[model samples]
Target: MHTSSARDAARIRVCHIVHSGKVGGVEVAAALLQAEQHPSINYQVAVLAQLPDGEPQAIKAPDCVGHGLNNPLSVLPVLKWLHRNAPDIVVASLWRSVLVGMVAKLINPKRKFVIFLHNTQYKNVLDRAAHRLGFRLADGIFCDAPATRQAMTAELPLETGQIHVVPLVARGGRSRHTPEAEQGPVGAVAGGEIRCVFWGRLAKQKRLDRAVHLLAELNNRATVPVRLDLLGPDEGELDEMLRLARSLGVEQQLHWHGAADWGRIRDVASGASFFIQLSDFEGLGMAAVEAMQLGLVPVVTPVGQIAEFTSDGVNALHFDSAAPVAERMLSVVGEPPMWERMSAAAVAEWSGQEDLSTAFETVCRQFLANQQANAANHVIRGAVS
Candidate 1:
């Protein structure tokens, strides 16, 4: 089964390549999955950019190498490194990594190149062109959301069967046996305030501003206080988002956690009962998934993978991205009892998903196994010929 201790039996090595080891959903997912990957699979990472300051060093791939992301010739060095080592399978994540994988595959044809797109792809004419190029280069295609898979497969002259749709990897699988009603610290919610949390980069796609507006909405109708804690690296828009939050008078209620790693964010989120995500779209939000793992109910608009994980009146409160953001927030957590039930449901639904590490490990082994079978078939056919 290629368990964590089955390394002695492993016949293949897998390398995961990402654009950076910075504090974001994709980077964090890569790190968490890497940690959980089975020992039997020689798991490694190739980071394409320098590790940002304050991000956990452990998140970087083991024996990982990085090429300065801004440098045009970055691919050449990475391509050379991968060529030298020649991992059995190279799973490249995000856009840059996909390009890196495509180039590296040209030099090492036998090496399986899997392009893992973990975000809502913005496809223009240029993007579609690159998609075609990626399709031509990839041995396997993985998209974090069904929409992403559709985008990759639709209008592209490629084998759609190769595309595999899955959520952003789920991390920290815990015993879901804890009754939802009694999941968090005792008396944590007695005050009637829903301690809400949000974690992600301060980018337009994340719609941090929309998230703040949602908080203002929740606060307006709250029986008590509803505080929002946003934890992530500030990618220059934190000030603008903060101004928006201030404009709404939620500056006091909004806690801007400029930049933080997973450990600190998770630790801080322990006190939070709800996770807020009102992004325009997401690939598969690792932040939202991590919060769900901790039993926090997600109140996210149905966009990208959010639709796949969240169900209205069920596990999560789904809102229209185009609707009044605050009005939607009010519906999700206005009633304390409703919030409690939703929280439990969120944990339950999250637990139903495959463990992040296990899912990644399975994917790696599947690629290697398929490669082996194809090789054996080629040999058999050669002898017959």
Candidate 2:
């Protein structure tokens, strides 16, 4: 991918390589960082795959080099493209992108490599091997969460100083927990329904079917009328989820929100009493974190970094299955004081978090300085020789 600004002598160019040109959490994070990054740094993206029609645009910022390879077989072309327009630094995101980035780095050893480790688990064996290779080959690593960094350190034989943990923060941050504009009038009651919100891709990893069953159990076993506003794009599993909800007689109670934009999600979150997700596992659980920062009580599974921040009855409730999840749900709804206390704790958890954009900038600057020092040392050695 060519960054025309790279030739401007005053600019420092960096590019992020990812598997797809779709609007997912990582893509959103990259877009946010590109928009908020230092003006002198020229940022671009090399999407490894061409996303299908109707998919959200991967790169949101203007003047971006959206390099999407049409097929996996075109690996040579991708490498040639990287070699032709080598950025000062290339950040590889996800396991697949890591593989591509490692190959590109081998072909063009002059460019600095940074692996963006976002997932704690790489399910594919070959991908996992490639991920480790990329980590070992990179000049630095940026972990999405502390837990992710710990996993990499424990399993991969790598230097600890090369890894940096940067926890992601939601946009539109505030000083304290406050009511959102989309929320009902403070303490207002309408139809006595408890509004629950869930956001993430509609796939098996999310375990949203668990959410449907939990809602049914909550409605059947408790006094509160529970309704879930399931937000996110369907990844070929929404049909099965709807069927399961219908079989359990919860079809009417479920609200299907298809791929809501960030602004719309913020509004929905403002009015929600609790945000719930029981994903099989999460790398960082950014969606859940966003909801918690909005002052919504979290009913999340103890997965990934979620367990590090949320306590069972303090900041968030834990839910592994239908029975226990319903029990916790009812407990939160029945006791207003209990949830209020949890809400305060939840806000406190994210109260003093450093802006994620600033964290990214800090790492980029630190690594850039290292790259320069290494170059200078090589120059000195050359002169001595």
Candidate 3:
């Protein structure tokens, strides 16, 4: 697995490690990096957990290796694989992946490890410790949002030079048209029926119950038809959300469409008038970004990097998660002009900067350059020592 001097000019092997092969921000980003084709670099992916049966049909990276590691002990197999393959650089896309990458680097100190911080979740002591250890062991840190980078520096006390802010690459697809380009329903339809679409796992962290309650509140006084479409896998939280919607007497207005295929999901999102994301926290709101790209006016809280891509009055209608979300939703639904402005801005923003190919190439190039420099530094240190 040792590198040959003659191979220096050839493609450098880079491996991306992720916790799961499921559809998420981190996984999508890693897939994009792996799928990128460049003359100077070759990419591979290793997933810690086995992808769900028939769930990963959408992923196009053929070289991605699924280790089927269901637990911490399963990481040993990954370590062995890494030892044999000996990637010039390893990029860990999640916390668990970062831990595994750090351990792999310890096994071979010459290996360069770069960690991508996808979210901001440093609440407990153990989480903080793991984050610090990963920061200290990795050669560089890549962050999608400013908040994530800030959290890393605060917790790890790393020098600013070691932190890199690379925005997440958008999923490639047709650019969604602006409201004017849209054929019908340019704004919130009259009669107060605001069609809001929410797409994500129905997990506790997502706090979809809050959205249900908001719909209930809106139904109390609103004359317009306010409908909410819940799209995602039906986890335990789905039942609870349904109960909440019923209790709020908005059951008739709420539609539950279980997990949809990517194409179907995009079609559903593109047809929606508004997109609502009520998650308490997020590393990067990929669904929100996708919805915005499709001309859906985003009504999201300022959590994670949602604010990074969206301006309060420019592209989205930002709301505090703790504030009167339902009341605000009603207000927006009642004002078609405001909705039109926000929807137009949302489409404009996505069209302007959410180009997946460009963003992916930029991050890949930066990562490869960093890895080359780190490899050279390791060689120099070894010679001196």
Candidate 4:
């Protein structure tokens, strides 16, 4: 119901297309951006896959569209939808969505397309080709981290001018910490319960097995008892990680809480003293940021844009995947003062300048300005003709 000025009446219509409507950091980010878009802009969302009946949905974008395409020819419906909607700009949030957007742009050459890079690495040949084609056809590119921006330019041979490094907006505010007394009768630490938390999908790329191994090694060396709380959705590699933990004889020290709701995940994180992310590569490390916000010192691999928000011995404790991860974790666990210092720094980092609202507004204004310029050029050309 918001309106714009006469000069701003040419509202930029933006559509965010993603592969799935399921809940995750990327989906949450898209939903946040959609909800926070300026009144002058027209926003819509389209998911390549449809959500099931009675599933809890988080998207607030005005006009959510879905295409239930299960086959190779399923892309046709998406292309047709794009043509019919004819948005002034389309932003694809994932690889498959990028491919759909590229084809849609190819069919309707007048519309502009943009790709938002959310992952740290790209390997699929089809996805790479589609991304390249999309880049060639896109008017601009938005990356969630500076490292990602650099990698994309190096990998695709694109100019720096075309790529923009817009860091991921922190979706949640400061988290409330739970006191030790309020932890709800969890076992005493005397039995060797050193609670460690890991949040992300249980996929091979995440290296969940490596995390479990690190926890097992910690338990082996600890004079006191220790336990690891592995929280996330079990996909392809969950069973492997569980079996590895059992084989190492540390299964008792590890607990699988399955995938948790965002609120519950935050609550679980508040009570834990440490968080670990063992991803082979990442774009922005959203969960790490969230964990830091909740006062959990993170022990993470220096991949993707992790170094942007964290530094070794500062906001976070960093470890290289090649080195002894278990040894690195032990060093922090053994030093109480160091752990406390890192936890304080982590909380401070989250409170610093990573405001999502400011970043979202900047991008929208830039998009609107560019659209208006293009419209002015068209008018000038028509007058001349």
Candidate 5:
């Protein structure tokens, strides 16, 4: 049996309340942070919905309150849990969790609350209104990237002091490309098949149709056969994307691996060449970073923090009407020197990031320290008065 020492018992308790316990970048990031062994932080993940079963879990969630987001009683269970457990701090991960955390703080104003911003775009007007109101009640905010923080402050009444930019580090993956291979002469590998991979939700914002078009264009230009792999759960665009690929006569070249964990992704994508994500917007484009960690050059639209980190024709190929995405990709495909250089650059960029668990702990402790300082000042002023 395991037991806590006095020092361990004295550590700050942190509960990250998330909307769902399913496998995705946000949920996986939260789960990994919770699993990290910290000397001064005891982390717990509480999902609004029941923990999912029999599906490939990215990381096992710790707690489930048995409530759904749309249910009117959703906040009550979370509030009740907060009261029963009395964690020292609550970090709400998504917009829905923000509402629950805001309500809990209103009822128990002594507890500290923080918001972890995940995206740069709002789902709707309702989401925008809720964030504007809910964020005002948060003690602090941690954004996935600077772009997320900038977008929030630009539209909402948020101060720069209240927000912190802490990029999430990629969970490790297998490296497929080597520096020697990258430095080779310009051309396709002898008898090699060109493979491209995309790992994210099949949603409209991802614009997967554009990926299919790119595939057709690549095959049209290349002497070798080209294939595209799609990974992640279908978020209502599967049928349309399949039909479009069929119409373009590239259905055979499209591979679908639904809702995969990181291990599975590495196993399947290890030999892949390019990681493609032309999302309309992203907080940090985490999957792209993950791909980079594996030495896969990115062919992404320069939006959100993707623009901040990637350099066009240097580490990545950026397309935004300056030229078609296919044209940019073809430029890399025909030039082994350029492709190898980009691959090496992508790997080096991600390897330079801080360790994942340490980054999370640092951000959480900063928020806790600030809250304690503020509380101490308030008490001192009261005693003086």
Candidate 6:
């Protein structure tokens, strides 16, 4: 993919390589960064895997390159493509993309390699090994949260200025009112019904089963009816979660909306009482931020970067135990004033975040300029010798 801007021909060109073009946080962030249209930079995405149809993406059609990774020979074309385009900076997101970028760097050592690490912990031994190798070859690094930066610093041999924490802000979702919009004095819920939402892959780490349990407990305690909307594609936990919901007799209350676009999710969640994510771990909890933008107070465990922005009882509710979280839900259900305050606070918290695209452009431009200086200095030393 080439940036055909003749006026901006001298601008820094960046190629972002991703493992896949799926609708995940990493992919979404890459898409948002491309949409920023930084004046000094031209951005394109090279997806390692074939892009599936109908995925809600902000990336321009002409600027994206996708090649399916089924065959071992698949990477050869990507390497060839890199050689043809020769971007000034190659930004690799995730470990898989890092490996691709490493090969691209080896092919042409002059190009700077930047690694974007999204998670605090590795998924397995293979992931750990890839991350170690990727970081070793990276000229600069981007971390989604301060927690991820600290974790990578301890695990990898990284210098202080190499890592930049640029948390992803909500970009795609549609919100009708501003955070300062006046919420109902009584509460967001209406007609004795409380609607809750959870969006992300339906996986074990997300603790959707725990959310189902909380739903049952909340229904038992509150006089109103509580419903939960489960969004995102299933990641092998649907069957088990469904069985649990059946056993608990709350299957009727749980609505499953798989892999929805941002607008659809926001539309479904507009009047929802709470957005719940009981995940065991997270980097920055992008979905929760999106939920907050929709004016739904978050009920999340204080894990990952979630603890940094969310103020329990002020902006959002915190989770320690399912029973306790359910109790808090009931408390809010009864106290309409408290519910209104939290709803407004949740939106306000999201409103205060930095625009992700602007932050990323600043960080990436600085990283490239610094790397160019180092290269020039090395050349000067060689000439002196």
Report model 1's TM-score to 2 decimal places.
Answer: 0.83
Model 2 lDDT per residue over 71-167, tens place: 5554565665566656888888887778778887887777889898876777678768877787668988888898888776666555434677767
Better of 4 and 6 by TM-score: 6
Which residue pairs clash within candidate 5?
A: 182-340, 186-336
List, residue by residue over 1-385, the lDDT tens digit for candidate 1.
5565465445456778887777776776677666665545566677877775555543655445565765667787677667666687788876667777888888778778888877666635655565567778888877776777765566655442456664564443442222355333211242556677887787777777777777777777666787888887777778898898889888999887766765577676777766778777777676676676666777787877678777887776665652464555455555667767776776676555665555666666665566677678779999999
Displacement of residue 223 (Cα, Å) in model 5 is 1.3
Every model: Cα RMSD to truth: 4.4, 4.9, 5.0, 5.1, 4.5, 4.0
lDDT tens digits, residue span 86-205, model 5: 888888887778888888889888788888888888877877777777777888888999998888766655443456777786565322222344322121222368888898888888
The TM-scores, one per candidate, come to 0.83, 0.83, 0.81, 0.82, 0.88, 0.88
Clashes of each: 0, 1, 4, 4, 2, 0
Compose the digit string of candidate 4's lDDT tens values, residues 60-175: 34254555534455477666666676787788877778877778778777777779987767757877787877788887787888888777766665433446666664544421
Quick one: best lDDT, which candidate? 5
- Report the alpha-carbon TM-score of model 3 versus the true structure: 0.81
Relative to the unseen true structure, what is the C-alpha lDDT of residue 363 in candidate 6, on a scale of 0 to 100? 83
Please report, in order, the local distance difference test score of every candidate based on alpha carbons. Answer: 0.68, 0.72, 0.68, 0.69, 0.76, 0.75
Per-residue CA lDDT of candidate 6, range 222-248, in tens? 777889998887879999998998999
The Cα RMSD of model 6 versus the native structure comes to 4.0
* Clash list (residue pairs), candidate 2: 183-271
